[model samples]
Target: MNFDKTELSDEELSRYSRQILLSDINYDGQLKLAQSHAVIFGLGGLGSPVSLYLAAAGVGKLTLVDFDSVDDSNLQRQIVHREANIGQAKVDSAKQNLQALNRHIQIATLNHSLDEAELLTLMESADIAIDCTDNFSSRFAINQACLQAKKPLVSGAAIRWEGQLTTYDFRQDNSPCYACLYKPGSHQELTCSQNGVLSPIVGMVGSMQSLEAVKALLGLPTLMGKLMILDGYTLQIRTLNLKKDTHCPVCQAQS
Candidate 1:
């Protein structure tokens, strides 16, 4: 793992000048990001910003998973797709957008649903996993896979101006899993399709998710054991401290 200085061409230096100006993520951090890989589930609202930022930030590889195609309804929040990509697969559209943003990175598109086996394969090479999916099934599946693989997971959700974020790192014995906060089959949850979401709300949360992902990949301290809730209507931010549940189905069996 010799992370020597990556020789940035003149064009790359000019392209990433803004990031290079930052003390926290100078040439070294940029090189680290360029060597990292991230898996993003869902190419919807949250996925849009998450993918965009990660690509622009110089992540080496990005694996995008989505089974849906773009439709007129998704334009309200899924910014990655446009009228030209209306009928194209979401993964395809996202890959195009990400490449256009930064062609230096590698973008892998998974135009299908993720099952346990598929997830395990993705996790094998992923440095971090991000849950941008709107459904509980996908989110829970990602959480379980992250736990099993001992990887860090950044989970985010938004619906009608309400957004929430949480990080689960199973490397720690007492860190909570996604199931600790939202139990499986506990209750029916509404998706963006059922309850509309504001376009920028998802952008805000998704960008935050990207930030957390970079932090996790860089081995920096992150919001790993906390739940951040944002109320767009009220413009208020709340942080809830979280703990691993001893009886949580996901964490319990592992412990």
Candidate 2:
């Protein structure tokens, strides 16, 4: 999906008037967002808000990827899917909802997983990639692809009253990849299904992912080299500086 127009239409200007009012994101910023493309993986809890806000915020193009079908259990946190879409593929459901939210944006859907090569090809035109995946394996794969592609990636995870958010802006020489923080197959993988997640926790993290994606596109400050940890139980947030892992196989090779 490509949006070639460099200017925002009157309708788009009105639709995103509030966002454009911000000094950091004036008309020029809104125009930039209107011409940007975002690729989102995993249309689940985090994806729900990320896609919704991006669409409503007037990102020109979006690529939604998810292979799972909507289940009854998903209605609680996956706000993008409705009860009627229970048996439908998540990407299809998300596309329907996102299109309905902002008809001006162009949206594409991929109802299957992508290999590293495929991921790189898909991200060729993407301004940013958002990782809403819950599993560590998917995170590791996405990180590697983004690193190779040299595209910015916004990564988020939430489970059991805890949430984490970060960005791996692979375009920068000093940006750290996800592998720098967690070694593959070393930390136990946790899922929302296995350990209950507070519905709002995902919403919070997903919303932040949307923010970071837009910031990255506009060349604004973001969590590019920082990790944010949220404790829903204590309602506390912590931000940690991330250093490039001198020994990280994934990023060290690129460096």
Candidate 3:
């Protein structure tokens, strides 16, 4: 579970030089990424690009969690999987591709579904959590776990021509958790399978999720406490403020 490298190699420096050059990142921020661990839930549409960009950005370790297998129908937006990976466990498929992307980073695959206890255990060591799952059940579970652990979370969703992004920096006292936005049972599962989707919309949201994760990892300013909505059809991006529900069950209990 601890695969952090002590230093970046010459090859890694060259691969990440463009980002390292940023005043916000510089060498210290890149080093922060090299020492961070991000646990990601699900390996479907949103997860695909989130994991890829995290690896390409040099996140030291990734814990990919999912129980489903790749299907022929997933190719449209699940960029991490291909025709060759059909029928393969999603976590396994994602691990294979992530390793291919960055051998220096460690990829850990959880091929089974996680119970609440299991999720809390896995998240204990994660610097951040990424929610890419398609259902409210998984999102609530991840939110609770991250809140308990005081870990940051980057969440993304996409359907049709719209994409949504949010971050919960649970380390902050006043930050809003997912439960602050949608309570349990308030959501009816609407999946891409039936709701329909545009491929690039999911990819765009996932990429933004990756960007948020990187910024969090580097201790830079991020979208925490804010919601970003992307209207791919109109090519418009909107940012909105969010307030924590003082009565939110999960967040209220944190105090």
Q: Tens-digit lDDT track for model 3 on 86-195?
A: 99999888898888889988888898879999989888888999999999888999999999999999999988899999999988899999999998888777888898
In the range 109-142, model 2's lDDT, one tens digit per residue, is: 9988898889889888788999999888888888
Question: Considering every candidate listed, which one attains the maximal lDDT?
Answer: 2
TM-score of 2: 0.98
Worst 10 residues of 1 by lDDT: 1-10
Clashing residue pairs found in predicted model 2: none
- The order of the candidates by lDDT, greatest first, is 2, 3, 1
Q: What is the C-alpha lDDT of each candidate?
A: 0.87, 0.92, 0.90
Q: Which candidate model has the greater TM-score, 2 or 3?
A: 2
Give the runs in model 3 whose Cα sits over 4 Å from its true position: 1-4
Error of 1 at 246 (Å): 1.5
| Candidate achieving higher TM-score, 1 or 3 | 3
Q: What TM-score against the true fold does each predicted structure earn? A: 0.94, 0.98, 0.97
Top model number, TM-score: 2
lDDT-wise, the better of 1 and 3 is 3
